[model samples]
Target: MICIMLVVAVVTTPGTSMASVKMEPLARTAPPPVEFKIQGSFDPSNSYLDQGTATISDNGNQTVKISVITEAKSSVASIGGTVYLQKWTGTQWINVGSASTISASNDWYFSGEVVKPAEQGYYFRARVVHWINHNGVYEQGETTSDSRLVS
Candidate 1:
């Protein structure tokens, strides 16, 4: 997980490819395949992006705002597959937010508030899986981001 702040990271895959990695039976020797890749903005507005930030809110229900980057490469190709937002209960993190898959043929802007936010003072994380062409699994998936603390 090379963190230059933000890179278009490649997620876990199902089958084997030159860039494939097995996350089910994770090989201790293998490393996390997520990377903060420099992106060329398709729009004539920005030049480059270094990172992304996921802002979580705890207003009434827990909500999360993901900063999205368009015109990205295969780095984010896998990340747009699945999103599972969870919050730490007393013992374990429970699914208290959004967890679903949607179309990503286009750019996925992550700048939106979710329905349920994480619990106050609880730990939260967003799990993303790279589905191959919106299929079941990717040749590679990783829990790239760490568990963010909910406030």
Candidate 2:
């Protein structure tokens, strides 16, 4: 009877099978958003301009200027940037072909600026990048990406 009972138990509870169970680590913490604001820039890094409240000058053609600090001061070769210009329609703000930013940064990156839109009320931003050590090194200030507001 004991032997029969043991055989039945073994059949009912198949021994550990690797395929039968999966073990995943408990999530350390819930992930936050990648881009909370749609089509916007505000660098948590502080090296680039602030996204929330950037200065946009309406000098006929607009001009944007902002300060940035390097997180790690290193000998760099070049910088990369992603420029995005935001235009205000009657109701909402939309992007107007912010440059693809296939460009590299020279000394101008040390002090950054972007040309404003020819049309009034259009804002501009230049996400400056510093190319370092033959590597595309950059810091978007204190955020995921750098950003500025054009007037």
Candidate 3:
């Protein structure tokens, strides 16, 4: 036979009302190790990306600038990605403009200004997919910037 116990206590404070509180024992469970979980064929440690960043700023003239910076661990055959300018339409994010570039270097930076005549009062952000091709292996990473209101 198993027994479960519960404790009840009355708590009071100075110049305050008194309330009854119930205390119960907590049940804890250990989580499975990461290696035991089933993952896809992609290995996370094989990525050559060092850092990726995206930014959006108001240009003060009915336009916003979206920028992206992608850095790799070392010089590769090709490095580039696509930058997408997105706008929040009360419920979902929609892409407004996009730019893609490819260069043979370790670091790549790109920026574009989008005219927002129809989306003046919406929130906007920048999303970038930074990729690198090194030793016949292709790896990519994504990053998103903080949202800003287009004025």
Candidate 4:
């Protein structure tokens, strides 16, 4: 004669379930609307100069064209300035090339332009030191253009 025995075991967490559970959705709100106001018009007669403009453009062939225009309130003995081509070197701006021009006689405005070869993958801008000579005294102002990249 022979004898045999059998045994079984089961385990589970105290406060957990084996089935999936759904979560509540989060709430989202939109921001408030914004408003803007306009002020008065500009008056140019109160200033010593009327306008000073500078610009820089890419020529699509590793070159750039820079230009500047300066206007004074009244005609002077002379009006002119130097146009500078500046390059961005990651830290600061440095002059690459420059050209200067003055009116042949008394004039109210002056303009100049220059074309310079630029390096590929670099930035450039135009800077002008505008000046006017009345009688014997000289008044000077400065203007800078928007930067452009050469491809």
**Which candidate leads in lDDT?**
4
- How many residue-pair clashes does candidate 1 contain? 19
Q: Of the candidates shown, which would achieve the greatest TM-score relative to the real structure?
A: 4
Q: What lDDT, from 0 to 1, does candidate 4 have?
A: 0.66
Each candidate structure's TM-score, on Cα atoms with residue i matched to residue i, is 0.39, 0.36, 0.59, 0.62
Span of 10 residues, lowest total lDDT, candidate 1: 40-49
lDDT value, candidate 1, whole model: 0.40
For residues 1-151, what per-residue lDDT tens digits would candidate 1 score against the true structure?
8767666776555565745553332122222234463322123222221223333333423344432222223333333334567654545655654575533443433232234455444556554433333233233232323555443
Candidate 3 residue pairs that clash: none
Q: Global CA lDDT of candidate 2, please?
A: 0.37
The segments of candidate 2 whose C-alpha lies over 4 angstroms from its true place after superposition are: 1-55, 61-72, 100-109, 121-151
Residue 20, candidate 4: how far off, in angstroms?
A: 59
Instruction: Give lDDT tens digits, candidate 2, residues 23-62.
Output: 3433222322233534333354534333322233444324
Let me know the TM-score candidate 2 reaches against the reference structure. Answer: 0.36
TM-score of 1: 0.39
Task: Let me know the TM-score candidate 3 reaches against the reference structure.
Answer: 0.59
Q: Report how far off residue 108 is in candidate 4 (Å).
A: 0.7
Clashing pairs in 4: none
Q: Deviation in angstroms for 132 in model 2?
A: 6.2
Model 1, position 9, has a per-residue lDDT of 75
Give candidate 1 misplaced runs (Cα > 4 Å): 1-62, 67-79, 106-116, 134-140
